[model samples]
Target chain A: AQTVTQSQPEMSVQEAETVTLSCTYDTSESNYYLFWYKQPPSRQMILVIRQEAYKQQNATENRFSVNFQKAAKSFSLKISDSQLGDTAMYFCALGGGSNYKLTFGKGTLLTVNP
Target chain B: DAGVTQSPTHLIKTRGQHVTLRCSPISGHKSVSWYQQVLGQGPQFIFQYYEKEERGRGNFPDRFSARQFPNYSSELNVNALLLGDSALYLCASSPRASSYNEQFFGPGTRLTVL
Candidate 1:
């Protein structure tokens, strides 16, 4: 079974600054995918970024990027130039080639202070 | 294009009662997945359907059942609901069964069991 863990329960960052949310997963499959999802006050889950395990290059989506360490089984999300709009509950997820089911971390409540 | 959509934004049910949640996948999407997000916890996979067929299921009890319609829409039925069943039910959709595809999510239906 695959499990994702987000050690930080909560995080805060000043506006215009940067923050990195850590995530790690336990999976025996060498071929998998990692994802970061954000849920705002509206309670809508939105995909932030995704990384393919086979791709050695990290995934970047504007200000959002992932530092995927396949050997370490770590996939952390970094939000640069954070804004108030970025404040939300962030969840880390893992999925392997054989399954479409996503295993998610506990989530980290992020707050961006102006 | 509109993303995934869920009906009955909120629902209240008594213990031992039954409830049903509905999800409409994004246009042209062939896969729909269900997840349960407890308070202060990440979403857990419940089921996945593709092309009106069950592709996967989570560790949930038999009381939890779901089906996909011909239109690719889905319904989740939970019989003999318990307090533990109270959570936000999220519906996600992807273009296909590939694990690398990013899923689009709905706002979620908040289920409260009293």
Candidate 2:
């Protein structure tokens, strides 16, 4: 079974600064996918970024990027130019090639300060 | 375009009762997945349906079940609910159940078992 872990329970960042959310996973599968999801007070889950295990290059989507270290089994999300809108509960998820289901971490509450 | 949508924005039930949650996938999506998000935790996969067939299931007990319709819409049914069952139920859809496809999520149905 694959499991994801987010050590930080809470985080805060000043507006326009950068923040990194840490994530780690345990999986035996060689082919898998890592994802970062955001949930605001509205309770909607939004995809922040995704990274494939096979890709050596990290995934970047505008201000959101991922630092994927396959050997270390770590996939961290980096949010640049943090804004008030970036405040949310961030979760790290894992999906394997054999199964389509996702395994998620407990989540980290991020508060962006103005 | 409309994102994934779930019915009954909020629900309340009691122990030994039953509950049904509905989900409408995005247009052109062929796969729908169900997840349960307990308070202060990440979402846990419950079931995944593709093309109206059961593609995958999580570690949940038999008390939970689901099915997909011809239009790719889906329903999650839970019987003999317990107070622990109170959580937010999320629906996600993808164009197909593939390693490269990223799932889109809905706002989710908040279920409260009192």
DockQ for all models, in order? 0.81, 0.74
TM-score of each: 0.98, 0.98
Tens digit per residue, CA lDDT, model 2, B51-94? 99998999999999999999889999999999999999999999
Taking the tens digit of each residue's C-alpha lDDT, what string does model 1 give over B19-114? 999999999999999999999999999999999888998999999999999999999999999999999999999989655788889999999999
Model 1 residue pairs with clashes: none
Model 1 residue B3 CA deviation in Å: 1.7
Lowest-scoring 10 consecutive residues by lDDT in candidate 1 chain B? B95-104
Q: Total backbone clashes of model 1? A: 0
Q: In candidate 2, residue B6 scores what lDDT?
A: 96
- Which consecutive 10 residues in model 1 chain A have the weakest lDDT in total? A94-103
Q: How far does residue B100 in candidate 1 sit from its true spot (Å)?
A: 2.2
**Fnat, 2 decimals, each candidate:** 0.83, 0.72
Model 2 has fnat of: 0.72
lDDT of each residue in A1-114, candidate 2, tens digit only? 899999999999999999999999999898998999999987688889999899999999999999999999999999999999999999999987788899999999999999
